[model samples]
Target chain A: MTQKYYAQIYVTLRPSVLDPAGVAVRSGVQQMGYDNVEQVRIGKYIEVTLNANSEDEAKTQLDRICDLLLANPVIETYRFDLTTVSSEVQTS
Target chain B: MTQKYYAQIYVTLRPSVLDPAGVAVRSGVQQMGYDNVEQVRIGKYIEVTLNANSEDEAKTQLDRICDLLLANPVIETYRFDLTTVSSEVQTS
Candidate 1:
């Protein structure tokens, strides 16, 4: 009876890190007709699906992942949310 | 009159790119007591607030930013959503 879980993680550069992508996007928005646009920043989203028994356990593991690999504390920051889907549930 | 705009960008590694962070997060989830957990992948998020007159124009600039800096099409991918806030609006 394995339970399914989904986690969404967002990662971004620290304000100190130069975000060329953000700058570029800002420029693009202006060109695309957003005359009022002034600044732009860029980041990432990671979605993970897995099986877990409990939310507490899943969260504990997620934190470790963030610290060890999902984010580089030196220059990037990360945040995440978790959701659970029971194996017994049906999707139509 | 100047308009305020908010843009959220999500960036991720192409499936071809080896995601060490994802792997690490997966491992962390397991350690955190998520016995049934299976897989994890990591990515980024960027938020930008600026001034824009029209959605079309803003979109254009956003696209340029993505191509020029926000996303590295070679190994990373990006997407964005835009919202407008009138300068006349007050936040208390």
Candidate 2:
């Protein structure tokens, strides 16, 4: 039986990698007087909706997607969560 | 009794808003032959590390930060999760 699945993927720079964009945003935030903020790191959040035969299939596909397209393994790491969506949404 | 906390924030465009970037990525993915992919959406993932007296204080600061710096209220919505971090890391 095929089911719809929703995946939320997060891709972040590894701690060793420098993030100039995040630094600029942190500076802006600090200038606004939120000085208690020690560090800020910015990354990518992606949402993917797809159909698969099983949770295992979805997870496998997601892993392949992330590795091939979503993240650069050298400087960034990625993680994702998958949830079952209403399979009947498009049928009727 | 200030403690260290880590906050992960996600900022995403509202469903009604159009996402050309996401569309482009989806097209790329489909070209890569992942035809089962139905849709793709992209957003920002931010990590903030801060010090606060209590969880309530941390939550308050996070909300204010999101409202003022991390997210644009016009087209995007933001959500965050906070976790306690070891305070001793900085001192040691």
**Compared with the true structure, what per-residue lDDT tens digits does model 1 show for residues B1-92?**
45677888777888889999878767776776655556677666778787655778767766776677667889988878888866568767
Off by over 4 Å in 2: A88-91, B88-91
Model 1 fnat? 0.86
Tell me the tens digit of each residue's lDDT in model 1 across A1-92. Answer: 45677988887788889988767766766676655556666666788886656787778766776777667899988888898876568667
User: Which predicted model would earn the best lDDT?
Assistant: 2
Worst 10 residues of 2 chain B by lDDT: B83-92
lDDT by residue (B1-92, candidate 2, tens digit) is 97889999999999999999999888988888878889999999999998889999999989988998888899999999999997566564
Candidate 2 C-alpha error for residue A9, in Å: 0.3
Which candidate leads in TM-score?
A: 2
Q: Per-candidate TM-score, first chain only?
A: 0.82, 0.92
Could you give candidate 2's per-residue lDDT for residues A12-45 as a string of tens digits? 9999999999999889888988788899999999
Query: In model 1, how many backbone clashes occur?
Result: 34
